[model samples]
Target: MKRHLLLTAICIITITLLNGQAQAQNLRAFMQNSGFLSLQTDTPYAETYLSVPGNSIVYKTGANGKYEGALEVTLLYLKDSNTVAAFDKYILRSPEIDDTSNITFNMLDIRRVSLPDGVYNVQMQVLDINSTDKEPLTLSQGLNMHFHRDSIDFSNIELIDSYAPTTTKNVFSKNGYDIKPYVFNYYPTSVNKISFYNEIYNLSKMVGDEDVIINYSVKHVQKDAVASNLFRFSKQKAAAVNIVFSEFDITDLPSGNYLLHIDVRNRKNVQLGEQNVFFQRSNKNSVGELSNISLLDVNHTFVTEIDPDSMVYFVKSLSPTAEMYEREYISTILQKNDPKLMQQFFYNFWQKRNPTEPEKEWAYYKRMVSYAAYNYKTAIDYGFETDRGRVYLQYGPPNHIDGSDREPGAYPYEIWQYYKLSNNQSNIHFVFCNADLVTNDYALIHSDALGELNDPRWRFKIYNTFKDGNGYRNFDIDYFRSTWGSQVDQYYGK
Candidate 1:
């Protein structure tokens, strides 16, 4: 199993002015971390990637009288949450800037740490060295590294931003290539291709004297089906460590959540091992595919059996799980209200999900839609239109829910935790709050899941505390402090 790790946190800091006055400001940066195993030395290691927007930090005049920004970074791996197993501390400096106001580039840094096989708690601390804030922005997550030398396994897939044949040895150099890691799994329209690197270990030991087939493909997260025009394979002689480095052109891929899968097989096509990495893509150009809907035929399809009046509702319920392009097509179909178009589009939707049994797929989804409508509907909206309803329909039921209704200084809130999402994201969380205090409708306030609303100061909105004299919520105050008689922190972390 691939142990994927993700941790994102934001902090506000106070910067000192030239005249010694202090001003509060937002310190914005993003960090992405992953772990991989080395087959050559039979060791495990962790990689940390940090990206800081140049405009978000305060640049100071250094010893050479040149403006530059710096961050103090500390990484700690703790065993059992108490004993430190590994630690790293260093200063990361940004490129020198002649004019601070025109700073538009991003500062990037990468670090690697090796460790023994065991589960550990990883803590990262980052501070703006140029700012007066004494406290650092801290975030923590769990890391598990377990690779056996006797069995075939795979390394965590590392997405690449850029790569070149290595001329010199450095932290980013691997297998004679200097790879710049793509810090985030998100790919916007600007990124046309997705490049990745992975290693298959102990293939020779597992499949002696046989050629192995390496299959890689991008698959839809919801459907678990290989995406069209995105599969590749190669045959190679068995080796102790096999490197797979490749890229896929996603310029025309639809906007949706997807997984890049790597599978190994023996000569007879028997599956050996497989791994996957989750990512999200946004491609507005892909919406042009909806124009092909007019070419679809639903005369003998399952959609034709549906009642005409329920066609729009059934199509609209798909908003929670529909891809970006599908959502647009749904809006267009609703506006046109052409029953033929709706039938064709609806049938094509399930056919794309489960080509062998499209009707069976829709049957399962119909039950879920009914469940959401019965449980989460309100006066003005159907269940699928509500935030909680949408989340349930999109991600399925959460593993755990922490609810509190009468906490002092806090509104009725529920924290939903999913042990693992369909996209391979683990330990995801969503926060919902009922501010109106009368209805069962709870609005989604925040979440730590990818592509979801992430509000570092979400507690403030739930508690309705920390407001300025202007009657507006004061967002500049401490973010993670627990208010009196509130258990939000505990609920969120749990």
Candidate 2:
């Protein structure tokens, strides 16, 4: 009986030691080093960490305060839309590390994986055996890593033809001031030697001099910075003149998005033209891989990309809905009973919204949609819900604007001014004056007031006239007669 009791005690002590060893080997904290950050292991037990770029790592613990015997790690490289799902799965299996008492377990080795040259994020998880301890710790990290390839001369890349250059209007306003007119277009990349041509005779109407200053900036998506180069062009003659731009080689740039801006100004340094454009260069394969390159479709009116084949395909995917209007019809759509026509509707919908190149317009269009969804989403949300958002998306920004809560004579009013008018400029003023006024007695209404109201049909008021031995008769209307809705009209329109 004595020998049996001693043996049992020894066995129980050995089992307890084994359990403690397992508990100490559990995961502590997951560290993701993006080639910029560093991770070190300090746990009592040896650990192994496995990783794949763009995927999260999960660590689970058991009820005994540790993982089972050996932990296995699976690495998955996500493709395209699988990002979110992968992240969620990782989070579902993560383990909770109790740092309250400062009792830390072993840390796994840090694993580094190469990622494509683009924006990406990595998540970490600790999977505890207890279902209750499965809380994942997620962190967002980015890698602006450049995937370089052997420099191949792109001199052979040629522009067979270019998109027909178009022009449109944009307005820039500060306080109550209006800037001059300006035109914008996508910088055509098909041709080796690019040039911009313009005539400036009509510009004299806004500024005393015929000369205008042009400023430009290039947005490089991968770099997250604007190009330092700025160019200036002076308009001197009524005759059409062309200026050639510096040669560009996209061979070194990563496959991603880009944008360019063109601002036209007069001698006064006032901004005449400020236009934003979006462009994208895509390689079906990785950045280092020699792959087929394509340009995304843009929908802006004046902006056009050189790839017409893609443009035609992009235009053929619009679906006609009950929301269609006469003005929304496209020349590309004539099929009354085409089954594949749904795609064509997609094309037309975007084509109509194109302010420049299809791709350029598409970016802004999506951004506008996003802005609307963020700012104006309601139980009944519409794309054109807010007046400010509508004007912002459709016409960019206004040149001149005035706003007041009071009516002109009784309430408030706002006025907008535009110094330059063209396809690019539309100046507007918003007036808010109460049309109703009860006088003590008789009052000569100003004739200008009658015309100002624009319709003898509507009720009128008197301005600068005397009533009850007092001179005060100024008539006004509170309705919106000008285009783009009056400032007060915006209140009612909303």
Off by over 4 Å in 2: 1-342, 348-357, 372-390, 406-426, 430-494
| Residue 182 C-alpha lDDT in model 2 | 12
Q: Give all candidates' CA lDDT scores.
A: 0.79, 0.30
**What is the per-residue lDDT of model 1 for residues 251-365, given as tens digits with 9 covering 90 to 100?**
9888887889999999999999888777888886776557688898778877888898899899999999898678878998899999999998998889977899999999999
State in Å the error of residue 487, model 2: 12
lDDT of 2 by residue, 1-494 (tens): 00000000000101112322322222333332221111122111101122211112222345756433232333332222124212222222223443212323332333345444332323334443322325432222222222212210000001111222223422222113222211112223332222222111223445544566655445542232453232344444211221212233443433334444445566667764343333444322223311211232324433343244444433322211111121123232333433234233444344544534545656665566566546534444343343333333434434655454333332222233333322232232222232233311111111111001111211112211112122112111122232222233343222
Distance (Å) between predicted and true CA of 169, model 1? 1.7
How well does each candidate superpose onto the true structure, as a TM-score?
A: 0.75, 0.22
- lDDT score of model 2? 0.30
Cα misplacement distance, residue 456 of candidate 1 (Å): 15
CA displacement after TM-score superposition, residue 127 of candidate 1 (Å): 1.6
Residue 478 error, candidate 1, Å: 19
